[model samples]
Target: MSDFLSSTLLFLLQASRMTILVSSAGLLIGFFIAVAIVGACLSHIPWLRRIGNLYTFVFRGIPLLVQLMLAYFFLPAAGIHVPAWVAAVVAISLCEGAYIGEILRGGFLGIPRGQIEACQMLGLPRLDVLFRVEIPQALKLTAPSLINEAILLIKASSLVSVVGVTEITRTAQNIASSTFRPLEAYAAAGLMYLVICGALALAGHYAERRLART
Candidate 1:
């Protein structure tokens, strides 16, 4: 019994590594896409703002599962031919980018107009003001929310199994099928997710404290 549990843990841990890798990649890529989205949304050009809003609307409106299926199945039909991992990451990035974009937009909006006026009065370049002052403050303001979004992303990554990426939930299913221990297998998977998310929460808290001090 002890050996069985240990082996199952090891197997699930292996699969969890894939989960971490994919989720981290998705979040990192999504964050950059989100920055772009926020820029478009906040642009002076009307069409650019509309395009950003449209992107956020479409991605946020569509179900992530549908998005994943479309990426995995429809893309090949359209001659894109991306690998499963690539498809999963792309879908996750797009979906999460929409949400993170909104979060960042909120953060930007929350910044004081006085700060912008001060920068302008000081003859600071627009780009310098935006990159050095606005973006940094926005990021600091949104760090907690972004951390929460990351945790949610990690949980949502279980859905990647449909794209043939063998993450934790899929590994649990396999273990259950072979060992006939569905409860144990799933419980272990749940525990793994808890550990990962808990650790992330702790790290986020530490970062938030550091940001606060700065």
Candidate 2:
């Protein structure tokens, strides 16, 4: 039991490091893609909007496992050689971008029409109005959703192990396989994940309250 605890704890430390790297990369990359997708969806160009909607639909509608597999397997056939870590990040970012884009779009739609009109009345440039007025409100409205999505990203990052990334789940699996103590290893992994998710949830609530107060 002591051996299992020690080994699991050690693996969890490794996993934590990998999880942070992958999750941060996924969220940072996904944020830009999400913004582009939302902008495209909201564009005046019909084809651009359609393309963006299709991107969101395809990514969001498909199972994440399938996306990960396609990235790791099929992309190689197309002459795009991505490392396992890169593939994992790409798959996660693409999947999360779809959902994030929708969240942002919903936030945009939720803005009061009067606010937009007021921006126009102030003689603000179109881009300035969007950046200064619309985006700020949208971000505030979407803060909770963004936090939830980030939690989802953290969980989803575990799936990267299928492609050979040594993330927390992968590390746990390795220890469990060698030690034959799957229960303990997995329980530790779950607890660590819970800690991270809980922390993010609390932070989200605090941010939401601050935003509301302002």
Using lDDT as the measure, the top candidate is: 1
lDDT of 1 by residue, 39-66 (tens): 9999999999999999999999999999
Tens digits of lDDT, candidate 2, 93-112: 89888988899999999999
lDDT of each: 0.94, 0.88
Question: In terms of TM-score, which candidate is strongest?
Answer: 1
CA error at residue 69 for candidate 1, angstroms: 0.5
Record all residue pairs in model 2 with backbone atoms less than 3 Å apart, i.e. clashing.
Answer: none
TM-scores for the candidates = 0.95, 0.92
Q: Count the backbone clashes (under 3 Å) in each candidate.
A: 0, 0
